[model samples]
Target chain A: MKKLWWKDKFNIFMAAIAYLTLLFIIAAIGTVIMKGFPHIGKSLATPEIQFAVKLSLYTSLISTVLCIVIAIPVAFVLARVDIPFKSLFNTLLDLPLALPPVVSGVCLLLFFGTTAFGAWLEEIGLPFVFTIKGIIIAQIFVNLPFMIRVMKSTILSVSPRLEFIARTLGCTPTQAFWKITLPLSRNGIIAGTVITWARALGEFGAALMLAGATRFRTETLPISLFLNMSTGDLEEAMAAANLLIIISIISLYIFNKLGGDFIGGTRGV
Target chain B: MIKLADVSITLGDFSLKNVHLEIRKGEFFTILGPTGTGKTVILELIAGLYRPDAGKVLINGADSENIPPEKREIGFVYQDYALFPHLNVYKNIAFGPRLRKMPPSAIKENVQGLADMLEITHLLARFPGTLSGGEQQRVSLARALIMKPKILLMDEPLSALDPNTKRMLCGELKRVHEKYRCTVVHVTHDFNEAAMLADRIGVILKGKVKQVGVPREVFERPRDQEVKNFLGVEPLKAVYAR
Candidate 1:
């Protein structure tokens, strides 16, 4: 079919914006790659760099697991249950996302610094003050909302009638959830897990304030990048940045390959 | 026997008024209504999916309030054939029996028997997404029937099929009913479908059951002018003459 001139103009306008956005992203990534690709292997030779990579991976993995454990039930409740003050709870769940990372870190620090709950946690031998454990806590605090939002939307997209059908076919509520809803929303959950892991991997301000970038102790990839750059170690800093970018790209690739639609303002599962 | 003793429920804009219905065991009872008449609500309430705001739903003379749908031994088939897309047809049909902890041999026999009956034996390995609408409906019917529910509730199960498929499935439904004699409450807006299958009809309009009688009585001798108009029939006097 032949297209009209105005339609062609509109198409060109949209394409131009899209290409401009793509060019900006590519240029930024290319700048980092050109500088850091040569130093990536060399930077790994430093024990601090090794510790940062290992710490980031371990904490992010642990936080993602924790997020999934909490998000499943929370997402299900948000999607299905008729709880009192539901909108209030939803707003509170998303409060961390609205706050700056530094503010979130400050809030966590205050709550766990000298409160009764903090004393109890310390007495129970799980002190979350400038420890690897604290790093995980900060990561979880920042990433939990992302996982929950993704999972809740995904579960909502599935008709609750399907669960009702399972119940009628002789399944209890829990049984129906496990056998039907979980499998149906598996891709979305996996996508959420990947996104959460990526976000946690590059978490900087909260991890810096709460965990305190101690060398070989609580330093993560982003914290390591900052610390190295401050010390005039540009190569090490760029290597860390490059590593984070590569991991995020790989995570997104896996997410898309597994049939996970983008979550946020974009269309999603 | 299935009884709704003045069951009523109101959700959002849709409401079911104080409605009473008694469907005898082994009878093919059809609730005929237009869209937005709360027909599906009645079925869900009977299946124990929705708790009625008032009144009682009794199965075999016992209140089924505390009984869950699965424990109530009621099977429900939705309009869209809600087969679990993650499972193949064989697994879908076997789901109920597996939940009941039937032995492997028994589950295999039951699934195979239903597959043969529905003539979906060759389609067992296929997923629901691959099957035609008619095939999915047959599989859904088999899934519900394999549980051997004391009462089966179907909500416009054939509405999505083509006319030819609908006719074929209607015959299959009748044959299945005649053989099993398990009580059936089928909901549909199509009077012709009700006429072909229902042992008795309950005409529901605006959340209330206006008439309950055999098809001939309801169609030929509508209680009032409203029913006559809703049914889109000639005047009652002319219907009687024909």
Candidate 2:
């Protein structure tokens, strides 16, 4: 018989702890499915739950596209150039990520509700307070920092020497970016897009604060779940919660497959 | 013709001060220096990649202050062979001509010609990541030469290759310069490279061009004590010493 060493005992203890955590996770998710599986079909037949699903998909798609369009150049500038107050600017960009989603929602609500600037925006035919557009705005505001953070690291992994070589091949700076840097950053763009879309799809507290919990109007999936649970409609709430759980599981699986293990963007991108 | 008239630049911890040099048309000139002596910086400056804080970079007797790198009509080969990993060898060589909006037939002809010349025609379909170090070196040469720039600047192009590959590429480099007859400015730390390829050599030390002469002259008689010590060949008569 082989003798067990101290390291062997330590390894077994750690492995046991990890397995326990995994077991608890499986139990929690399994119970949610068992409670809600039968009512999901009934919930889907209802118009209110259907509206929530459609609204969530529509708003998240738009916000993800907007974030990508805005994040690329901002990330490029942050990663490539030596701008004034770069560290300070980076910290300011990250503040949204560090703060709670509710705080960002409150900040947005006050700025767009009480100020003359908000009134001016309203006069110009763009109103954001408690509207569907407000949901999209909150999503963008919440997820832009994560998208930019991923993109900046992605841009850093590509060497500037490739762009310099492109210039020698008759490419202007803009042309070089399109031909060289952008092509090299295809994986990073995909990773950034996937993570942003997932976050936007599930944004809850900020959407509730900024877009309001109005049924059939600003009702997203999480909002639908919140409203049904609060009104003591356990069957409808369970169905909505189950739908969210399935989506969350799928998105997380995709993110783990496509994105890096950590938030520092993909390696060798 | 290229000339740097009393050029000086200071960036962060590195500085190049009071550097003056001239290269005649169609001449193969080599700038020889030890590591981190800013030899590559000089090549980049000549290629319009950098601007001197104090003096003008004159290309064909015109001040290069307004010339961006794209419009400078200069080709640069980097030490690391920075071929675009996303582009195959054919597209890599054809990049410049396509940008010029040359007709497809002409672009194909040009790409094939340079690839054939560099002996990389077989690797045209393969991306840069698949190529060996020597193969990448040849592909990079083809990529730059495809532009047909009047001035070709190389920065330690052979440093990354193995010893055997370096010797072979060094001979090919001379042959390519002769065939193209473009004004060549090659930077390297090896004394043997300058001795073999340069019509004239500039020895840079401590951010200055300490001596500019034919290889024989510079090798036989170094400028000062620092250069004499740096070249590492004692000027002594063995019989007299005995």
Using lDDT, give the best candidate's number: 1
Chain A TM-scores, all candidates?
0.92, 0.92
lDDT of 2 by residue, A1-269 (tens): 76664458788888889999999999998987999998899989899989999999999999999999999999999999889999999999999998899999999999888899988988998788999999999999999988898888878878999998888788899999999999988877887787788789889888788889999999988898889989988888888888878877776666666656444543222
Clashing pairs in 1: none
Model 2 chain A: worst 10 consecutive residues (lDDT sum): A260-269
Q: Name the 10 consecutive residues with the lowest summed lDDT in model 2 chain B.
A: B233-242
Clashing pairs in 2: none
Error of 1 at A195 (Å): 1.1
What iRMS does model 1 reach?
A: 0.8
lDDT of each: 0.89, 0.87
**Tens digit per residue, CA lDDT, model 1, A186-224:** 888877788789899999888777778787798899999
Cα error, residue A232 of model 1, in Å, equals 0.7
State the TM-score, rounded to 2 decimals, of chain A in model 2.
0.92
